[model samples]
Target: MKQGVQGSPGKPVAARVPAQARPAADGGPYRERDASVRGEHTHEERPGAGQRATVQRSSVRGQILDALRTALATGELKPGEVHSAPVLGERFGVSATPVREAMQQLALEGAVEVVPNRGFRVVERGARELAELAEVRALLEVPVMLRLARTVPAERWTELRPLAEETVRAAAMGCPAGYAESDRAFHRELLALSGNEQLVRIADDLHRRAQWPPVRHGRADLVADAAEHMALLDALAVGDLDVVRGLMGEHFAGTG
Candidate 1:
């Protein structure tokens, strides 16, 4: 049995009842026990509920990842945070399997590191490391923004205004999910302006990583960030390639 702190000490642990123990459609002894447990329901009792729960679980995983990312961004999930797979699994009411999977994904994205016996933990970035990464992103994206300025038509600028408005609203409201989505929308519009599909994909991957930090709603940080974005748009509007490049460099530097 997988041991985890399911509840308060000595509280009846979640019994690892097997699939075969679940009631066969006829409502046998299995159904009786399943029903007697107060407020406890299994996937077998409600067919669609299982699917719904699976969806909910997937959503929860996303939430967990968001939480993990926030912790890392804010330096909570630091070098010695003891981010054991089993402990995290227990906190999220999931088996270690999904936690391991999520950790592996994080590792692939440079968010976490896995040590042989210690499981996984956030990757600590030194000042120099962060500066270098920021420089790399700036080199890759600044020219892209300049290219967009030269290539994107006037009509496309108007088309992008709505998403920019949405981003401003999201940042103002301090809704993390809304902010994340709106931020994505704003960048996607920028990428679309470039008209290079490959550039769009690469830019998306880099942009998504910036959403890791948690922003307090209505905070000065968000307001300042939004103002910077507005500045970027204004520079783009003027077709000032050098200014746009500088703004993009600053924007990515802020992310790191």
Candidate 2:
């Protein structure tokens, strides 16, 4: 069984919100700044008319994809449920084209499957499939973590304290979507310290899929899982390889 951090709560750790999700300076909805060099150009120097339309369509598709993923993680889109692009487009105040494009991406990710002449059905994952995913994740991450435990400095691990605490707080809030996002943020940050972007991307994909299944456990189970983040950090900070190994093993096992 997985072990959790015991005893009373520690001092509050400041949460680190992702920059893209943070409120804008003017208090408007958070908008992703265009990173392309085109952003430096004036409206006159921007892309051609058709190119502009393409960019707008791509942005809409991306937004719909993010929203759909959130819905899947939160159980708003239940397993084995079928959702039509037209209906989803109406909900998002967009046309069916972008929604269909986004759902196609989800299909490629194995989160949903296309139904001929119908719609996409959220893939119903069984316990065995989830266990396989957990096993693969453990295989990929456990060794990387062990190597980092030996090489990364204690101060580096200390820097991640806020992210770990954020997971705990998100879990306590009882919102699976919030907890899922925070949980991924913590893991992604930790893996990124290895300076391997490809590894982080692959692990993130698996993590997102694991979150698609409805959370079968209650709030206490979530808190326990979240507590392991802090505990893992503690072990890493002290260079305790044995503790790190144990915690990582149980942590992935619990996800099965």
Q: TM-scores of the models, in the given order?
A: 0.67, 0.77
Cα lDDT over the full model 2 = 0.75
Q: Relative to the true structure, how large is the alpha-carbon lDDT of every model?
A: 0.59, 0.75
The candidate that achieves the highest lDDT relative to the unseen native structure: 2
Q: What C-alpha lDDT, on a 0 to 100 scale, does residue 169 get in candidate 2?
A: 96
Summarize candidate 2's per-residue lDDT along 1-256 as a digit string, tens digits. 1111112243111122233332222323333334244464323223345454555666767877777776777666777878787666545555567678889999988899999987898899998988898999999999999999999999999999999999999889876777888888999999999999999999998887887775534788789999999999999999999999999998888772
Q: For candidate 1, what is the lDDT?
A: 0.59
Cα lDDT tens digits, model 1, 55-160, are: 4445545655665554554434555344676676556544555456667777877766787887775565565665665676677667777877887766767767
Going through the candidates in the order shown, the clash numbers are 1, 0
